[model samples]
Target: DASWISNGNVNGLGWSLKDQMGSEYFGLRACNRSLSALHAEMEGLLWATSCMRDMRITSVRFETDCSDLVDMTTNPMEWPTFATEIEMYQRLQEDFEDVSLSHILRSRNGRADALAKKARNRGYIFSHIDQTRSYGGVLRRIGSYIST
Candidate 1:
């Protein structure tokens, strides 16, 4: 999910990885300059995908509450505004053996929505990754915060 400050040029992007049992194993929050909410969502997905690849996570399913993002990825030619982002997303998918994006109800995505809002309200400019499950002894990595 993504959040935009009303009077500023900053946008917050957040994403979380959950297991089949609905347990959140990983999550991220970051701030960036996005042209629109759709763009912010795309940025969040890109960051999350890169992180998954870094961790050697090959098969995954990404869920978002943004239906437009799903549509944009499914039919890239119809969304010219997000052509570049869609292209980048396709390139990232190549790293994984199987990957898919699906839309879920907003009510089912509270955690990610709240994280995005918190990052936007706090003006956080760095990426923070929280790994609940230990991945080869790598627990968590707190990025250096940059003040605006």
Candidate 2:
């Protein structure tokens, strides 16, 4: 769960950045909402922070196409209505030693985006095909699995 939730834009992983939440981040108005959400980065950052705060760790190398959020999270610069956003992000990022920012293309964010959308529509009341877990145990260590 921890790994899947925070796994950034990686090959065959989830969509990076604001796209991370997948379709769950949208609704019937998905198309328009997605574009509107793109106007800023802090929105997702805040949500991610909410999801990650229990780990008791800080400092992260955050990346995304949403440069506005990257700037707001790391630069301490003022953004319109940014204070609230930072409050959450700072809480999450504070565990890190250094929070670097990286920008990547949107194509890399599809899997996670799909998962997010699925979660939103289904209320996350069922098993996940992604094998996502919350206790950082989702990713099975090599040689630890076998067919019974």
Candidate 3:
């Protein structure tokens, strides 16, 4: 999910990855230059893809509430405005064995939506990785420190 604060020209991007059981394994919230909500959604997906690649995740199915994003990603030629970003996504997909993007109802994406809104409101960046389950690693926070 992504959010924009017009006053500060801040764009907040957020994404959450969950297993079949619906437990979150990874999530991120970041602030960036102001962009349209659609562009911000694409940025969030790019960030999520890069993070999953770093974790050596071989297969992924990304879900977003933006139908236009899904169409743009699935058929890049159809969305000229996002041609560069679509090309970037293709490059990132090479690292994975399989990848797919789907659209979901906005109501079903509350967590990611909240994270994006929080980042927009706070005007900062942060990431939360739940590595404790299988990676035998502690939760890591890397970014500006600010009170909630």
* Winner by TM-score: 1
Candidate 2 lDDT over 1-148, as tens digits, reads 0112222221111222222322122111011122234332344444444333433324444456556556665676666566665666666566666656566555654544554454434322222221122234343322211111
RMSD of each: 4.5, 11.3, 4.8
Ranking by lDDT: 1, 3, 2
lDDT of 1 by residue, 1-148 (tens): 8886556556776777766543455544656568777778888888888878987889999999999989999999999988888899999999999999999999998888887877777665766666454456554443322334
lDDT of 2 at 113: 55
Q: Quick one: best lDDT, which candidate?
A: 1
- lDDT by residue for model 3 (1-148), tens: 8886556656766677766543455555666664577888888888889888987989999889999989998788889988989999999999999999999999998878887787777665555544323233444333332322
Better of 1 and 3 by lDDT: 1
Q: Of the pair 1 and 3, which is ahead by TM-score?
A: 1
- Superposed by TM-score, candidate 2 places the C-alpha of residue 125 at a distance from the truth, in angstroms, of 9.9
Error of 2 at 105 (Å): 0.7
Candidate 1's displacement at residue 126, Å, is 1.1
TM-score order of candidates, top first = 1, 3, 2
- Quote the RMSD, in angstroms, for model 1: 4.5
> What is candidate 1's CA lDDT for residue 118?
72
| Whole-model Cα lDDT of every candidate shown, in order | 0.77, 0.38, 0.75
